[model samples]
Target: MVAQEQKSSHVFDLLVVGGGVNGAGIARDASGRGASVLLVEQDDLANYTSSSSTKLIHGGLRYLEYYEFRLVREALIERDRLLAIAPHIMWPLRFVLPHSKLVRPAWMLRAGLFLYDHLAPHMKLPKSRGIDLRNHSAGKPLKSEYSKAFVYSDGWVEDSRLVVLNAMDAAARGADIRVRTRLAAAKRVDGVWEAQIEDKRSGETSTVRARAVVNAAGPWVARLLSDELAVPHSKSVRLVKGSHIVVPRVFEGPQCYIFQNPDKRIVFAIPYERKFTLIGTTDEAWGEAPGRVEISPEEVSYLCESVNRYFEKPVSPSDVVWSYAGLRPLYDDAAANASAVTRDYVLDLDTTGGAPLLSIFGGKITTYRKLAEHAIEKLIPEMPVLAGQSWTADAALPGGDLGVGGFEAALKRLRDAAPFLSLTHAWRLTRAYGSRAYDVVGAAGTLEDMGENFGADLTAREVDYLIDNEWAVTAEDVLWRRSKLGLHMTQEQRTKVERYIADRQH
Candidate 1:
């Protein structure tokens, strides 16, 4: 971790629990405002829902039916802002919504598209338009029945990296970011929170004093409030399990597809990792206690079938290369169906005990910045020490500055500097690290200079960089979360990565 300016007593101005997008974002914004913040995470950053998203910074095109104009507008506005600041990890994606007469009529699709385009005038993406799928390249994979589609714009994101970049920026601004650490307990005392934080690696408990606390724990928000913090009112989260499957490139194209199911749900099939096509996201009602979520057999079948209704080539369970599941801790609106639940967030602030406690309920990735801004703004009155007026809107995240020439220009420059790197290898490094790719490949004159090959372009040098800089301690953190190289590597190669990380730490 980078060293920061520390208070002599170590009494922080803010103690943030959870290191997901919301918590990390809050830490970045709060710390930028000069708050001495300490953020604690039970596991790795974005280890759960934050990383396991459909990986889009979209305006919830489907939520228009549910009349969530406020969320969609906020998301649409924030989406452009994020794209402007982080072009390396974020870019524009055009979605093709094929006309399914049996599902929704063309008029409804057109109406929704019209509303979506006009809702946020600041949207830099082109407005929606009707397309002739019969002749377009995107239509080549679709069945003959789908002759038309509504093409609209949204942005794709590296979800896990987004969380990490936020945490990195926060740490750079003097916030202490502790991963693999759990918030054991806390109590209100003398207008401050006396919190017990335990480092999971060492199991050593330490007391942290903070004038204010923000509960941004995603799935465990309610449990932490009632159990650990012991000061709660009546806000809860409804766990909705969403799962996705990765398959070999289904078709060739940059444009993604949005399929409408018979059950009134929408499924997306996006181009992923240059070599594979990504399909997702079923909203299954979860009743069990929150834990590691996995895609059930039924869900895989459902996803395959959802796309089968439109695609020419059929996909089956055997074709799936990988699958993942995550729990969406939506605000408990008592909606009968999981899909009907609101994606909007609720921030509950309880100041009854003199010490302020703010709890965030439901949120999506697209608007995490705004959520953080609002969260910090609400606590500002109580935390007079925190200064600044919403500075994150104009700031660039760590490694986001790609200069005037932007991504393509930077890629060209990296390839020029590291002449030995293959086109694919250079692209991977640039996408993952942006301007910092040079640092990862520092002074490496050849492939051999990159150190030991852990298969699929993952070199020992890169692993060491992730460890020393990105807080990567395990192979899974490198292969799966840091980058999705695990999908392309063999079991033996993955084991090598595991052994290497173990040996390095030892």
Candidate 2:
């Protein structure tokens, strides 16, 4: 960590505001190119929109209909690159899209899949194909009327961990990362950006200087510009709330389903954490603050109804074990319907009177790396000291260097080396930390050496690693973001973990 005094005293090449995927990616990219960077987040990493995604590294299949060919093609290509870099956190998943003659015609579906397949022609993932649902394993859980389905491949991600990984890589590359630090104000002074940042935990405020600023505040982008920097941007963001619900496993297979709703939106039911089914996402206009966004009663009903349309068994609000909502800061294009808004990002570079401030509007996780590369390209003319060329394209994120052995082979090696660990526990560690799992499991020959088990295989040693390395302070950061142990733990167990974190802080 960069010392507080040093952070305030030194002038950085870039000051990245917001610790979501975009900001983290930019910090990592800039630091890799030899630019001095400091990134500040107002809350825990991925505590907002980044953690609340549907957890897919997918090319927006539906976006093709909106004529967003460029975005789809870019995302499709990125899917392969992400899979190669972080095989543990990201992998290919087959999506079962049941055909509804009453809705989209068979020809239209086929045409869309064909375009999707050819868009990224070199992608090694399986091509889309029609399946006989009556005889397929995916069919057994669906309604009897659905006899045919379309299966296509996309990627799933550990959403919050992805953000943490990028931040980790950035820090490793010499970028200063500060979580729970809020940007209070900024002004152009003597051809540089002078900013005041407040640490939310300690109530300490400090001033930092930077050659440039990046507003990757996700939902708070526009507000940060107007309120903190007092700069007006011609582009505005539309906050659309998307909600997801988790219930007990609804199907027997590993495959996920993409169901078409009567309202023309789609919802996904994916296998989650080996014990639950994840279903989601309703797009609705939101005017509320982005922090701590919650799923509405109506959204719960909407998700349940959407899944029930295809699944044999129905689910209701009572069946939902967990639900979360996030606000997407989409670039406002004056589209009439919330669902019609484009997912493409727009970068506004403000060099109005003095130092430059780059504001990012609307971006999905699938294309964050490319977005960062583009951001650096735009800033290079102003900041010529930024090293030549983009380097993140082939670089591996922290703990993602599994070599040619790959994730499965790495998992086998982990279990083999840690004979004392149960298969489930070892698997969990491998999935969460990749090659760095050994670092967490270090020298412990027995379960007793792991220290205080709060529940669901969560131990003190793992928590310490998160605290010391990943900037995890609260139990919620451990249970929810760094890992999903909360879903498996009881309230008493959670309370115990919370107390453990509190005790360690003292």
In the predicted model 1, the residue pairs found to clash are none
Report, for every candidate in turn, its global Cα lDDT versus the true structure.
Answer: 0.92, 0.92
For candidate 2, write residues 1-107 as lDDT tens digits.
34353245689999999999999999999999889999999999998999999999999999998999999999999999998888889989999999987779889
* Candidate 1 accuracy as lDDT: 0.92
- Model 1, span 1-506: residue lDDT tens: 33222123567988999999999999999999999999999999999999999999999999999999999999999999999888889999999999999989999999999999999876689999998988888899999999999999999999999999899999999999999989989998888888888877876777889888999999999999989998757889999999999999998879999999999999999999988999999999988888799999999999999999999999999999999999999999999899999999999999877888999999999999999999988998888877587899879887788777999898999999998999999988988888989999988999999999989999999999988877788999899988999988999999999999999888
Which sections of candidate 2 miss by over 4 Å? 1-7
Stretch of 10 with least lDDT, candidate 2 = 1-10
> Model 1, residue 52: displacement in angstroms?
0.7
